[model samples]
Target chain A: MITQQDFEQIQDAIAGKLSADEQQAYNKRLSTDSNFAEDAFLQDKLKNILSDKPFDEFRGTLMRIETEYHYLGLWRTTETSETFSIEDILAMFEPVAHYEQALSHADLRAAGTALLQPQNGSNFLPNDTLTFAWAAALTEPLVLSIENNQEDVVLQDTIETGTVSHNITLPNLPAGRYYFKLTGNNSGMYIGMFFVNKNLLDEL
Target chain B: MVTLQQTQAFMNSKHTLNSNEQEKNTRIIDGFKNNNTRIIGECYAEMYPLIVRYITNNSGDETTAKEIIWECFEVFFKNCTKPDFVLNAKFSSYIHSIANNIWLKRLRDNKKYTYTDITITESSRHDFDDDTDNPYASDIDDYTDQITETIYENDLSHVIRQLLLELTEECKTIFRLKHEEEQSHEEIASLLQISIDMSKSRLYRCSIKMAQAIKNSPYYRELIDGFPFLTNYTNKKRKS
Candidate 1:
C-alpha cells in the first residue's frame, strides 16, 4: 500500500535529506502508522543490503586467488608420486615429498642417503637462504644440482666430504617450481624440490 | 626429532627475526586489514603448511585442515576489518589460534573423536592471555558474537544479492548507480541518457519489486518471527 511518494519520503528521511517540517511529519507517521514504519524499516534494511559491494568484491578476489593456489597444486593430496606419471606430476608444481619414493625399494636401500633439508614440495621466497644438508661420514665429494621444469640446470655446486650442511643464499629466481638433486660419489642420490613464489615475495 | 631445547630455540628464532622480517610482518598485517589479494594469497602459502602440520599431527587430515583454515580466514578477515580491532600478536599466530579453536570445536561437535585437550602453544598463549599486549584479550567471545551476527547478515545479504541479480540489466545498473555510487536521479539520468522522470520511475519500480520479493520470502518470515518487534508488524499486516 506504500506509494512511490511514501517510499521516496522514507528514503529521504533515512538519508537525512528531509527538511525540519517534513522530518517531523515523517516521524509522526512512523510512530502512528505501523504500515509506514514497516516500510521504512524494510527500506533501511535494503539500503544496508545494497551497501555490501566491498564485501562482494573482496570475496571475488579471494575466489580468484584460491583458484590460482589450486592450480599451483597447493591443495593436492600428499600422496607419493606412485599415483601419477612423471609427466603428469611434472606438468604442475607438485609439492610432494620424497620423490625418490617413486624408485624401486632396492635403489632406495643402495642410495643410503641422509636426511635432506626442504623435504621437497615446499615454497620459498626468492631471497630465502636454504640449508642443504647430507650425511657427514661420506668421504667422496657431492654435487648439488638444481634444475628448472625444462630440465635446465639453474644452479650447481660441489661439496667436499665431511661437510654435513651447506647454506646457499638463493638467487632471485622467477616464480615456478625447481628440482634439486644431490649426488654423492659413493652414496645414493637425494632429490628434492621447492617453489620460488613471486607472490609471497611481492606481498612481503 | 624435536627436543625441548630445539623448540625453545625455534621460539627464540622467531623473536629474534631481523628488521626486514619485522617489516614484512607489518606489511602483511596492514595488507590484511586493507584486504589486499596478494597479501591474502601469501598468507595462504605461508600459513597453510603450519595449519596442515598441526591438523595432521592431531586427529585431522588435509581436507579438514583446508576447510577449517578457510573458515578461520573468513572469520579472521571479518574481525580484522573492524575499526576497533587490534591484533597484539603476529598475524599468522592469531589465525593459527583461530584455526585451533575452530578445529577443537569441530572435534567436540563430532563426538566421535575422544576429546584430547590440545594446549595452545607458548606464543599464542601469551598473545591470548596478556591484556596489556592484546587489546582484545577476550577475543574468543568477541569473535563468537561477531560470527553469529555475520552469519545472519551474510545470509540476508546473499538472498538479496541473488534477487538483485535476477533484475534486468538496466535495473541492476540503476540500483548500482543509486545505491552504490550514491548518484542522484538527475545524475543517473544524465549518465544513462534517460529523462529524469524515467530514471526516477524505473528506480521506484525496481525498489517496489525488491520489497515485495523480500516480503514474500520464507527467510524474511523466519527473520521476522525471531524478532519480536518485527512480529508486531507481521501481526498487524495479517489483521489488515
Candidate 2:
C-alpha cells in the first residue's frame, strides 16, 4: 500500500531531487524493505511509461488498428470492414500471446523462472484452482503480479520463500488473458501471459 | 516538441531502403496491421536480452532496462506504422540502435548511469530534447497542436482516450481537464459550470463506466489481460 507521500518520495528519489538525509532514508528503505523496493520499481516503471511520447503514439495507432482489425482480413463480408466478431478477435490474439511467450523466454531464462501450469495458450476453467510455479533458489523475496491490459494490477504480492510453487484458488476470475511479471533482488524481470476460460473451471 | 512529420522524417532519413527492402517493409507493416504477433514477438525475443545486457552493463538497474526495452518496442512499432516508414537496415539492428538511443537519453535525464567504458555510437544521437519543429498554418495546425499537446504533455494511450469517449460529453471534458490538464476539481467544476461536489461525483461515475467498458469490450479483454499497467491502475484505485 503505497501512500501518496511514498509515491512523491519515490519520484523525488528517482529524480535525484531528494536531500542527502532524505536520500539516505530512501536508500535504507529500498534495501531493507521489500514492499518499499517493489513500490519504487513500480513507480519508476509508471514514470518511464508515461514520459514516453513516441511509443504512446504508436500504441494509440495500433489500438486503432485493433479497434478496426475484425473489419479487415476475415470479416469483409460487406462494405463495412469496421464490424468485428469476438471469436475472430480471439483467434487473432492467439499468435499475439504465442509470440509474447516466445519473447518472455529470454527474460525467464535470464531469471531462471518458468511458469508451469496454465502455460501459454493453455486453457483453464474459470472455477479451477490455478497453480503458479517458478524455478528459484533466492535469498530474497520476489514480487509476483498479475496485470490486465489496461496496465492495472489485479493480483500482486511478495513471494517470500525457498519453496518454488504457489497454488491459488482464483476468486471467480474474469475470463480473458493476463500478464504475470516476477521481479526481485534487482536481478531481472520475468514476464509471461496466461488465459482464463470463461467456462466455469471446476474446483476439484 | 516533435511533430509527427518531423519524427517520421528523422526516422526515415536515418536509413535508405532499397527496392527489395521496401517490399519487406511493406510486409512488416502488413504484419502489424494484421496483428501478426509473430513478427513483433520475434523482434522482442531477439532484442530484449541485448537491451538488458546493455542496461545492466551500465549504471542502470534491471528495472530501468526493462522500461527502456519496452520503450524501444513501442518506438519500433510506431515507426513501422508511419506512412513513409522504412527499414534501411536490418530490423534487429535498427531496433537495437533505438534501444541504445533511448537508454542514453534515460541516463542523461537521470544522471544516474555513470558509465566508465560504454562508448556512445551514432545510434546514441537523438534530438528528442530539441524543440525546433513548429506546427504549420490553419485548422491542421490546431489538430496538430492538439496531438502535440497530447504527446508532449499527456503521454497517455488511445485506449484511455477511447475510455473517456465512453462517458457523456461533459464527463469526457471534465476527465480530460482533470487527468490530462491536471486541473483541480474546483477548476474543472468552474470550467464545466458544475458544482465541486457534482464534479467529484461525475469523475467517480466516469471512472466506474470506464472500468465497466474495459471489462465489457472484447478489444480490451484480450489486451487488458496482458497489460499490467492498466489493471494495476484499477486495482490501486479500487483499494484507494
Candidate 3:
C-alpha cells in the first residue's frame, strides 16, 4: 500500500522537481511500491491534449494525388480510365470485430486487444476504421489523364493486405489541386471523392 | 499563487497567451508549414537536443526517443497549419507530459509494465549559519521554518521546469498542456492546428518515451528497490 507521503514523493519525482538526494530517497521508496509511481490523473490530462491536435493536411492531400499514364499503346490516360479491383486490395482490409457485448464473457475475452486495434478485425462499431485495402477496394483507384494534371503521384507500393492501414508521403506538390475519380468493378462505384488540400506534414 | 484548476485550465485552453509569445510561436510554426528551412532549422536545433535527452532518460532507447520527439513536433506543426488552432499552455510542459503518457500507455498496452531503478527523496537543504547572524534571515529557525519553506518552494519549481525543458519540445508541450492547461482534445487541436487523430498518436508516442526515460534513470531503479509489487511484476516479466 502507498502511504500519502510516498504518493507525494512519487508526484515530486515525476514532476522533475526533486533534489538529487531527495530523489534518491524517493527512489528507495518507489522500489517498494512502483505501481503507485504512476499518476493516472496526470496521464489522462496529457492524453487529452495530444489527442485534440489537427490532421496533417499535406499528407492527407498527397494521399489523393493521381498520376496519368498510357497503357497497351492506347491513350487510356489515368483521368478517363475505367475502374478495376485487385486481389491485394481485397485481402488487405480486415473486417472490424463485431463484438456482441451481451454474449458470453468468453467472447469478450477473445476480443482482447482487438478493442485497442480498432482499425483491424470486423467492424463491431460504426466508428471502427477499415483497412487501406478496404479503402482502396471500396473506392477503386481513380485513373486520370496526363494533360489534366502533371503532379508526380504514383501508388508507391501495392496496398498491403490485412487490417493495418498505411500512409504514403509525397513532397513538393504545387499549390493548385483538384479531385480524383475512382473507376473499378462498377458494382459499387462513386463511394466518395477526396479533395487535394494544401496542408503539409511536419518534418519528422 | 495559481490554483491547480487554473493552471490546468491554462494548459488545456484553446487560447493561451494574448502577448508576444503567442505571435512568436505562431510565426515559427508558420515558417515550418511554409518549409522556411532557415527558421525551421533554428527551431528544430533548439528543440531536438531536449527531446533526445528526455527520451533517452525514459525507458526508450535512442531510436524510440528520436521517433517520439520527432513525431510530437511533426504532429505539432501539422496542427499549426489549421486556422482555428491557437497556442495553449506553456509549450514545454505540454510536450513533456504527452511524451511521458505515450510511453506509459505503451507499457500498459504491452502488459510489459516493469520498473527500473529511480531515486526519491524528502529533504536535502541544510543551514549552517546561526539563527541570529543573517540580516534577512527569518526570526524563527524551525526545521520546518518559513524561510526554508520559501526556498524549497521557489527552487523546486525552477529546477523542475528546467529539467522538463531539457526534454523535447513535444514532450514538454504535452506535459504542460495536460497538467498546466488541462485542455480537451478539441481545444488542443484548435490550439496546435493538428487533427485529433494526429494529436492522439503524438501523445502516445511521446509518453511512451518518457516512461522509458524514467524507468532507465538510475534513480528510478533505486526507488523501486524494495517494492514487492514492482519486484513481482519485474520478476514475472524478467528482462534479460
**Which TM-score value belongs to model 2?**
0.30
Chain B TM-score for the candidates in order: 0.53, 0.43, 0.39
In model 3 chain A, the worst 10-residue window by lDDT is: A66-75
Give the residue spans of candidate 2 off by over 4 A.
A1-204, B1-23, B113-240
Top lDDT hit: 1
Q: What fraction of the native alpha-carbon contacts across the interface, defined at 8 angstroms, is recovered by model 3? A: 0.02
Better of 1 and 2 by DockQ: 1
Could you tell me which 10 consecutive residues in candidate 3 chain B have the lowest summed lDDT? B120-129
Error of 2 at A104 (Å): 38
Query: Runs in model 1 with CA error above 4 Å?
Result: A24-38, A49-53, A74-204, B1-29, B42-79, B86-139, B227-240
**Interface RMSD to the true structure, each candidate:** 7.2, 11.1, 13.9
Ranking by TM-score: 1, 2, 3
lDDT of 3 at B28: 71
Q: Which candidate is the best by DockQ?
A: 1
Looking at model 1, residue B52 earns an lDDT score of: 75
- lDDT value, residue A99 of candidate 1: 48
CA lDDT of each prediction against the hidden true structure: 0.65, 0.53, 0.39
- Model 3 lDDT tens row, B16-65: 34355457566776775775543444444444455556655555576676
lDDT of 2 at A18: 87
Please give the TM-score that candidate 3 achieves against the real structure.
Answer: 0.25
